[model samples]
Each structure stands twice: as C-alpha cells, then as structure tokens.
Target chain A: MTIEDLIEEFDDLGDWADQCEVLIDMGRDLSNMSDNLKTEDTKVHGCQSNVWMVAEVKSEPLRIELTADSDAMLVRGLLSVVLMVYSNRSPQEILETDVRDIFSRLGLDRHLSPARKNGLSGMVTRVRAIAAEAVGLQS
Target chain B: MTTDMSQRPPFDVEAVRGDFPILNRPLESGRHRKGKPPAFLDSGASAQKPQCVIDREREVEEQFFANAYRGVYYFGARVDEELEATRSGIAKFIGAESTDEIIFTSGTTMSLNLVARAWGGKFLEPGDEVLITEMEHHANIVPWQMACAERGATLRWLPLTEDRRLDMSRLDEFLTPKTKMLAVTSMSNVLGTINAISELARRAHDVGSLICVDAAQSVPHRMTDASGQHNEVEPVDFLAFSGHKLYGPTGVGVLYGRRDLLCEMNPFLGGGHMISQVYRDHSTWADPPAKFEAGTLPIVQAIALGAAVEYVSGLGLDRIHAHESQLLGYAHEQLATISGLTIYGPDLEHKGAICSFTIDGAAAEDLANLLDIRGVFVRHGHHCAMPLHEVLGVQASVRASFGVYNSCSDIDRLVDGLQFALERLIVAEK
Candidate 1:
C-alpha cells in the first residue's frame, strides 16, 4: 500500500494496541539496510535508539534510493514510512516534498513519544539533507 | 532447591506509597481493581520524590532562596545556617568523618568528574595506573579515562566475570604498586551484583592506593553508612550518589572525600566561592567542602536532598533493604517461570532489587514500550554502562529496579506485560 493509504489504516485502528501491532508489523516487513552502509556518517544522532539511514544516488531517471534501519522496532516502522514516501523519488521531488506536513497529517508527531518524535524528525531531516546534498552534487 | 525465605517487611509499604504522591498518579490504563499502584521499576535512573522532599524544595524556593554564604540578611543567613546542618546530616548519612569531607556537586556525574579532575589531575604521575571495573557506569569510567589522558597515567580494568561479578583472581595484578587509584561501583546498575567494597577498599589501602565507591545505586536501595552498623561496609576514600536517586530533586549530588585528601587536593573549578582570599596575581583556596562547592549552590535541591535523606532514615535503611530483598526474591521466582528470559546479575542472593533481562526474541526497547502502555515503567538501553553490556555480549537490556515503595505485585505486572509483548509482538508474527 502507499504511505498515505497505510496512514489512513493507522487512523482507522481504534486501539493503541492495534496501532502498535500495525507498526510492529510494518517493522517486520521492512527491508534490512546492508551492514556496510550502517557507518558513522549515516548514523542519526539525538535518538535514544540507534538509527542509520543512507541514500544511494540513482542515475538516468535521477530517483533517490533511500535505505534506513533502527535497532528499535518502532523506529524501524517509522523508517519504513520514510522509505515509502522519499525513496525512489527524484532528488528534486524528494527535496520539494514536505515530509513534516505528511507526518502531521498522519498525526505521527503527536502520537509518538518525545524521544521517538525526536528520532523520527532526526531520520526525516537526515534524509532531506542527503537529498539536498545529492541534488547539489549533480549540479 | 528454592526455599520460602520471604519475611514480612517491618514498615507499611502502603503508608510509604502514600508519602510519594506520584505513585498515586492515574496511569494511562488507570488503577487496578485489586488496587495495584503504578509500577515504577526504574529507580536506578531516578526515583519518585516523596511529599516531604517536594515540600522542602518548595519551602526553600518560596521562602528561603537567597544566595548562600554572601548575605548578612535574615533569609540568606538562615539558609546558610540550615545548609550547614544539612551538610552534617549528609556526612553522618554516609558515615563520613566530618562535614569537611562532603562536597556537593551537580550530580553523580559531576561528583565523579570533580574527583577525576581534581584528585587524579593533581596526583596521577607518568605510568601510574588508575584501575576501574568492567561493570562501572560511564560516569565512573569516562572521567578517569580523561584524567589518565591528561596525566599520562595508564587506565586498567578488572574484568567482569561470566558469573556477573568482578573477577578478583587477578586483584593483585590489577592493583599493583603502580596503581594510584581504584574506582569501583558499590553495585552494578545493570547486573545488580553487589561488589565487596570494604575488602576492595582495604586491599587498595594496603597497596597504598585509594578507592572511590560509586554509591549512586546503593545509597537509594540500602544503608550506605560505611560503619559496621546494618549491613554496612567500611567507607572508602571517596563516595558519590545523586540526591534525585535518593527521592530528592535533581541538581544536587554529594561527594564524600577523606578530609586530609580533600584539603591537599587542588580546587577543580577556579571561582569566587572556592577561594579564601583573592589577590590580583593569585588566590588561596577555601576549606575542603567549600573549596569544591564553587559558585551559587543548588540550595532548593540540597534542602530537598536533606529531607529525602531524613525520610529514608525515618523509614530505616535496614527495613528498606529487607523489604526490597523480599520483593526481589519473589520477582526472581516469577521471572524464572518465563521461557527464554535471561536475567543479568548474580543469582538473587548477592544482588540488589534490579532485574536486567532480555527475552528470547523480543528487543529491550520494544518490551519497554509495551510495558509503558501497561503502566509498568522500566529502563531500556545501555543504562550508561555500554561497556558492561558489551561484556555481556548484548547490545541492550531492560532494567526493572525497585525502590522502597515497590511491591511484589509490581513484579507480577512486569512479568505479565512481558508475556503480552511476547505473545503479541514477537510470537504472533510467527
């Protein structure tokens, strides 16, 4: 399903337990980021959990390839949402996309704990920064 | 092989619970039909403040907050006068020789840093070894590493054994004549293994080296007076604990040092209050405790800490220790029933009421989140003891450390929550 569609599914889930289960489910299905890419530069700080995100430059169509991983299940689920939205998008498109607005629309910013919120924002910010850098390097 | 060794606690835990208003706070799941209180199992990080401590802090802030030691005014002078009394109480609490030995710092971290910088910086010569254990929290480890770097001293560590206690077989090897100091935790925050502090302290002294006990965990859970009174051990040269962990407010920590050593040490931070007399070119330092306590003190928190210590004393440390031991024993029995659950630390007998565990397929962070939703608070991650976790060969673990207010039912809730997390998150997927 698309990212927006999954968020709607999250909104439909009435109980906290159900939402948590869905998030954990998302985590279980997440494609593991290769260990080689999980290096110091790719590591996201300010997370209570360790999270690493890396973006590979795609040629021709100029789509940005993003991969992320977290030691925490909830953080991994959040990373999945970022992967659904930002991955395989053109560098310009990824930069233009308001990820924070998307997160607000999904009510993720309010739902997650302060620590998790910080982690989510850190992941999103790092991805956006990489996208911006990737676009800059091409020019 | 297990025996029913549990005895009834002397004091009323329910009455103790009433003193902590935070325990009565309505959890997200609300209170139980059986009247179970909120399971606060993370006292190793910080404890819930009692009403007395809260009131004392408010009283200090609302009525008697003025810059201490500088004012001749009624409020400021009164605060200073009261603080001196509090200093004596703190000294007696840890069984220090005098109030001259007790130095207040920001917290355990700041206190350890003070010792490492002031004492280690001044005394540590080239090729001198500063020894610490594998189980020490980063607060106790990192500062010494920095000190060793500054002073050209080598850092050595006594390895934590597979059995979760320190390997003392090479005690002589680790504590050589070159060893200038030994920094050890009174209890491991993760493993909960109580170290043989007095023996180690005596050993260190015999070798002509000093020892510093990181009493941050032990001070809250049990009696810390180094005198041979209730489950007491001989006091070491330096001891440190945070006020917040002892049911007081944050921003206050006590560091107890030997009077002679403190007098001889150079002042860590060069500031106004730490100086006795200031000259344009140089300044002579103040007396030991004041020499260390530079700048405006955390007056409110310090007063709250005094109240906290009094509250604990009122409860009686021996009684508290016994009660927690009973709960911890019961918790061990309950946890043993769970499959694929591995707990860190020595078997129940030698440890505090801390249970650091990881389930077979469940991640520590995931289990903690699930437990949080169920109103069972626990600490997850390295718990500032990453080196210890590395030694255990695990990335992280969930720690449920009990305080005086914790009950047997709290452990039940934790175990039940772990089961729910396992069934729903880990097993359901399969």
Candidate 2:
C-alpha cells in the first residue's frame, strides 16, 4: 500500500490500543533482514531501542531503496512508515520531501514519545545523508 | 513472602497519594481510559514532589525569593537561613557529624563529579586504583573513569554474581592496597540490589581506602546513616544523593564529606562564593561547603528540599520502607505468574522497591509504551546502567519502581498492562 493509504489507516484507528495494534501488525510485515545488514555502521544512536538501517542506490531510476529493522515492535512499525515514504525515491526527491509533517499528520508525533520521535528523525536524517552521498557520487 | 498489612501500623497510602498532585490527575495521553489516575512506577528515576514541597517552592518564589548569601537584606537572610536549615536537616537525616559535611551541588551526578575531581585529583597517584561496581549507574562510573585517566590511576570493578548481586567473595581480590577509593552504590538503580554498605565500608577502611557512596537510590528508600551514628555501618568518607529522587526539587543534591577530607581537598569549581580572598594571581578558598559550592546555588529548589526532608521525616522512613517492601513483594508475586517474564536482581530480602524485568519476546520500549497507554508510567531501557544491563544479559528492561504514594492497585494495573502488551505484541509475532 502507498504511504497515504497507511496514513489513512492510522487515522481510522480509534485509540492508542488500535493504533498500537495496527503498528505492530505493520512491523510484522517488515521485509526480512539479514544479521550482516544489522552492523554498527547502520545502527542509529541516541535511540532507546536498537534500530539498524541500510540504503541501496539503484542506478536504473537513480532511486534509494531503504531497508531497516528494530528490536522494538513500535520502532519497526515506525521504520516501515519511514521506508514507505523515502524508499524508491530520487536523491533530490528524498531531500525535498516533508516527512516530519507527514508523521505529524499521521498523529505518530502525538502518539510516539519525544525519545522515539528523535529515533524517527534520526532514520530520516540517515536516509537523507545516503541520498546526499549518492548525489555527490553522481556529480 | 509478603507481610500481613494488618499486623503493622496502617500506612495510609490513599492519604499519601492525595499529597502528590500528579497522582490525582489523569494521563495527558488520554489513550484508553479517560479518567484513570496515572500509576507512577518510575520513582527510581525521580520521585514526584509532594504538595508541601511544591508549596515551599512557590513560597520562596512569591514571598521571599533572593540569591542565597548575596545580601544582608531580609529576603537574602531568610534564604540563607532556609538553606542552612536544609543543610542541618539533611545532615541529621543521614546521621552526619555536622552540617559542615553537607555540600550542595546541582544533582547526584555533580556531587559524584566533585568528589572525583576535588578528592581524586589531589590524592590519586600513579599505580593507584579506584574500585567501583558493574551495577553502578553511569553517573557513578564515568566520573571515576575520567578521574583515573586524569590522575594516572587505574579503574577497577567489583563484578556482580550470576544473580546480579555483588560478588562479595571477590572483595579481597578487587579492594587492594593500591585501591585509593572504593566508590559503590548503596543500591542498584536497575537490579534494586541493596549492597552491604557497612561491610564494604569496613573492608575499604581496613585497606586504608576512602569509601564513597552513591546513595541516590538508597537515601529515599531506606534509612542512611552516613556517619555510622546509631548504626553498625562504618563511617563513609564521602556520600552523594539527589534531592529530586527524595521527592524534593531538581537542580539540588547533597555531597557529604568527612570534615578532614573536605578541608584537605582542593576546591572543585573556582568562582564567586567558594573563595574567601581573591588576588590578581591567586586566591584563598573558603571552608568545606563554600569551597565546593562555587556558583549561585539553586536557592528556591534547595529551600523546597528542606520541606521534602520534613515531609518524609514526618511520615517516618521505617513506615515508608515497610509499605514499599510489601508492594515490592506483591509485585514479585504477581509478575512471576506471567509466562515469559523474568525479574532481574537478588531475592526480595536484598532488594529495595525497584523491580526490573524483561519478557521473552516483548521489547522493553514497546512494553513501556503499552503500559503508558494504560496510564501506568514505568521506566525502560538500560536505566543508565549499561554495564549492569550487559551483566544481566539484556540490552534493555522495564523497571517498575515504587514510592510512598504507590499501592497494590498500581501493581495490579502494571500487571494488567503487561498482559495486554504481551497479548498484542507477542501474539502478532506468531
């Protein structure tokens, strides 16, 4: 499903319990991650939960494909949302997108804690950094 | 293992709960229950301020707020007297020899750092060692590491046993002649393991090493006799505790030092009030406390801390300890019934009010968030003790620490929240 569809799904959820249930379900559907990808380089710092992310630069469309995982179910769900927004996007597109507003619109900002919000932002920054690097390499 | 509440003097937890305004309010999240009172179980992090403490703070701000020791005006004199009153109260509370022993700092972290820099900086020599423990919070561990590095001394650790208790058997091996200091926590913030401070203090003294205590966790939960007055515990050279953890205000903590040691140690921070005479090139320092307290103190917060001490003292520490002990036992009894739950630390006998645990599949963060949804507040993650978490064989764990305001009902809500989290998260895994 598209990121907008996921946002709509979150909006339709009743309370925190419903939101949490749907989020954990999204986490369950996360792409299978290898132990090798879960390295120190991919690890997100200043997070209460362990989160690892990787970005692969695709030459065909010049898009960045993001894959990530977290030991925390909520963080995994957050990763899913993050990947859905930034993955398969051009470096310029990735840089220009307003994902923080998108997260706030989805009510994830209100639902997730300040600490978790920091982790989410950290993921976004990592993806942007990779895309920026790709732009550098292309230049 | 829980005591019969009927046999003991009735601890009116409901009345106590009324004193903490936060306990009466609904959760700000407004998630599941609309009007459920927040079950605050993270007092180990920082206790909720009592109404008296809050009032005391407001009184200072509204009535007679002034920079402490700055002026001879009525407000300034009143502020100084208030601060000195707190110093005397705290000195008495911890069974210290004199109010001169009490040196106020920003918090426990600063108190510890002062001891490390002022004491260790002057005293530590090459080949000397500072022995700490694996279960110490980062606040207790990092300062010593910095001190040892700067002073050319070695930092050693007293390891925890398989059950997370300190390895008392290895005491001789760790505490050597070279051990200039034995910095230990009175109680583990994560494991809730109450160490035998008296024994450790005695042994450290036997080896001619000064014993410093991180009493942040213990001072609130149990009676602390820092000077060994009316207690079997040996007099510790240095002791540190935060006011916030004792149901006071933030931005204030106490560092108790032996009179002789405080006199001998160099000033930690060189600034306005800490010195007696200033010269163009060099300056003479003030006595013990003023020497350590270099800057303008947390005047309002420190005054309110005096109220916090009075509040707790009026209630009696023994009663609070007994009440929390019952709650801890009840929590253990209930949590054990959960299929995959594993509580860390020693048995009920050796623990304080903290209960840190992890489920087989549930992440600590996820569980804590779920608990929050149910209006149950708990602390998660390594609890600022990464080495202890490493020793406990987990990256993170959920901690439910009790205070005087907590009751058995809070534990019930915690269990219910945990079960709900388990059903939602663990079931989704399959």
Model 1, B1-430: lDDT tens per residue?
1123345346788899899998997754422223345789999899999999999988888887898889999999989987888898888787877788888898999999999999998999999999999999999999999999999999999987778898888798899989999999999999899998888988898888989889999998766765434345555888999999999899999999888889998898888699999999999999989999889989888877899989988777778888999999998899989999999999877899799998887788889888876778899999999999889999899999999899988899999988888887678777
Evaluate every candidate with DockQ and list the scores. 0.42, 0.79
lDDT of 2 by residue, B146-255 (tens): 99999899999999898889999999999999899999999999999999999999999999999999999999988889899867568999999999999999999999
Runs of candidate 2 with Cα error greater than 4 angstroms are: A135-139, B1-9
Q: Which DockQ-derived CAPRI band holds candidate 1?
A: acceptable
**Each model's total of backbone clashes:** 0, 0
Alpha-carbon RMSD, each predicted model: 3.6, 2.4
TM-score, per-candidate, Cα-based: 0.94, 0.97
Q: For model 1 chain B, where is the 10-residue window of minimal lDDT?
A: B1-10
Give one digit per residue, the lDDT tens place, for model 2 in A1-139. Answer: 8988878887887577788888888888898579999989989887889899888999987999988998988888888888888989999999999689888888877777687778778888888888899999999
User: What is the DockQ score of candidate 1, to 2 decimals?
Assistant: 0.42
Candidate lDDT scores, in order, read 0.85, 0.91
